[model samples]
Target: MLQAHEADIFRPDVTVLAPQEAVPARRERFATRLSPQDLERRAWKRRVNTIHVNTDVVVKAVARFDQMLADLADDVEGQCLVVPAPSGAGKSHLLARLQMRPSLVPFRDEVGPVRPLVFIKAPSPCTLKTLGLALYVALTDLELSATLKEHDIWRRVRHQMHAQLVSVVMVDEFHHALRGRTGDERRALVETLKNLVIPDPNDPLRPPGAEMRPISLVLSGMPWLRRVLKEDFQLLRRCIFMPIRPLGHSAACVKKATKFLELIEPRLGFPAPSGLSEHDMVQRMLKASAGYTGRMMHLVKKAAFRAIRSGAPSISQLDHLAFVFDEIFELGPHRNPFRVPDISTCPKLKEIEFDKLTRLMGTAQADIDPDDA
Candidate 1:
């Protein structure tokens, strides 16, 4: 080999190497604190990172609902989709996920961004005026200073929706319209919604060169929403009901739980002292969650935080999760599924029935109302 030049050998721009490699950035974990606000924010943010266990039922339901939405986009006469479920059954989560689909992507023209899907929550004690105001704020991102008449608000709502080319309007907690309202009021509310979907013959909102297509409605609420819809046959006829049931103790449920545990284990930032995928463990988890996916996530998050705070390198089923149920959720000793020996035969598991209506209405309808409101 030729001898290197003196200038090159003694170059001042030589890069120095360290003996140890640089550490990679780690995912931010929840701070070990008791602040309610911090915990709530962390919990909400963690929702995005949590594993979404899609059982067959969820897949089929999503496919069917998506197909309906696609059909509505191309049709002149818009239809309605009613998603009814119990509390903590992941209805909001499902709708949120659905809103992210490419189908809901905003359309752009020479003017600016035109959002196709308008998602709004029905205000508490929802009336036609409140509902219209909610939609107005969601569409225009502005509040009304002057109190406008219900008719004026609705007219503006329709015009804005048409101008913006909104294809679907998903209203969450739609059952609020029925809550603490008279029968006539409920009927009037339903009529207002109907009018929005299909404008009156002499509607003033049909401006020159305005798109005449109807805007589809996607309403999600508790099971009582079905009962509310039953009051108006016309409204019920326009809707396609899609029921979201809670996860029960079945082979499919077990499989989903196992898959979820497997996916989440790595992301938990700590190892599990025992296998979380075992049959008994899965059953116990189901019981603890009361067969609800949202509750299951809540339990898991609480347990994970407990493990992190205790300076544990791994989560222990006996030490961490058992204590979490007993302390955090305040389950009685006899009713604590995690602490119990036989989860399959646990009395609390038996109490976790699919019929949430029983709690709401006191008795199950022998024949569910045909209107299914």
Candidate 2:
């Protein structure tokens, strides 16, 4: 060997690490304050961490939804209510709670000896078959012990579902199904929903509206879903469309904001971290967040990282929230980044920011009146 130190056989860096070991370390996939075990227990927690909360509004919405289902079991012929809230308004969270509420059990008792409440989150498959399949999956997920094809599963499911007196189908992410590529796909959704809703020939009861789709539904998604429905006014009129406005700075919103944060805090590292004074920091967070649920969490999550890296011991409140808005959003004093309304005990009207806009002068040429030009 010309030089032992330079020989390829002596390449210490290459020989020391295996290819897999050489791979760069990735950041943990776990939520900020979550222990690894917590994610596995809930199963849905990781998925949920990605969703923001607008609970103050959603609680009331879920209550109304509960009542609607109760009305359905009583054969009250209720029109389906679509709780149309913003993307980050925790629409899915509301849907989850609707299934978990204590009020729901009574509907089952009155409707049948063992009525099962079914909740399905639409999958990305976007076809009728896949949606139907997903519904089956959701049922199984609910611990129904019903397999997809166990000799007359649908027949058994149909009877069992019917006998229970009330089967409420709540589909979160209704928008995915709305974007059907072909008429067949769209028709499939319409038909499947029709089957779940309106009476099938084999169905025990005719759809409430007769011509209307039955099976009480709480179809929810972002604002765009409403527009998608509006494309077909006939179909939309059948729905009880109630839109949830995003939360902005207000007393009620503050309470909601705090509650939501508290829900996540224990998991995200808490007593809300050291610097956070409940009264002062929460208000600051409310202002900085502009009352957008998702954005607020995004800020806090990022702040957690910042705090962790800096060894700040717990990020109660980080000033970086202001930077993200001021620098990235260019939101200055007296300006808000979100379009949500302020909270109020009474219904309030929306205001237009006319002062920020300039109107062009009228285009007509002036009459030649003694050299006015």
Q: Give me the candidate number with maximum TM-score.
A: 1
User: Can you write out model 2's per-residue Cα lDDT over 1-373, one digit (the tens) per residue?
Assistant: 5586568577657656566655542233433676665544344334434544445556677667767766665552434568665434445555666677774553424434543466666665345555555665555444334345432444444444454544577777676655535655565355445455545555443433233324677787645556445544445666776665656667787677677677655565433354332655556555544455644566566555454444454553324444433443443433432222331221222111111110111111111113211
Q: Encode model 1's per-residue lDDT on 1-373: one tens digit a residue.
A: 4368877787779864453432221212433545886665466446524656675556766787688677765765667888887655666667776787797888789986688899987887778778889999999999864489877887788778777888789998787777677888788778767655665566565655675677778898767787677777876888888777666777887788787777666667664444666778878888776676656665676677776666566767767788876775455767778877777666653322333422232322222233442
In order, the Cα lDDT scores of the candidates are 0.70, 0.51
The prediction achieving the highest lDDT against the true structure is: 1
Q: Could you give me the TM-score of model 1 versus the true structure?
A: 0.74
lDDT value for model 1: 0.70
Q: What is the TM-score of each candidate against the true structure?
A: 0.74, 0.53
Q: Which stretches of candidate 2 lie over 4 Å from their true place?
A: 1-55, 76-78, 103-115, 141-160, 163-166, 200-214, 227-235, 248-290, 297-313, 316-373
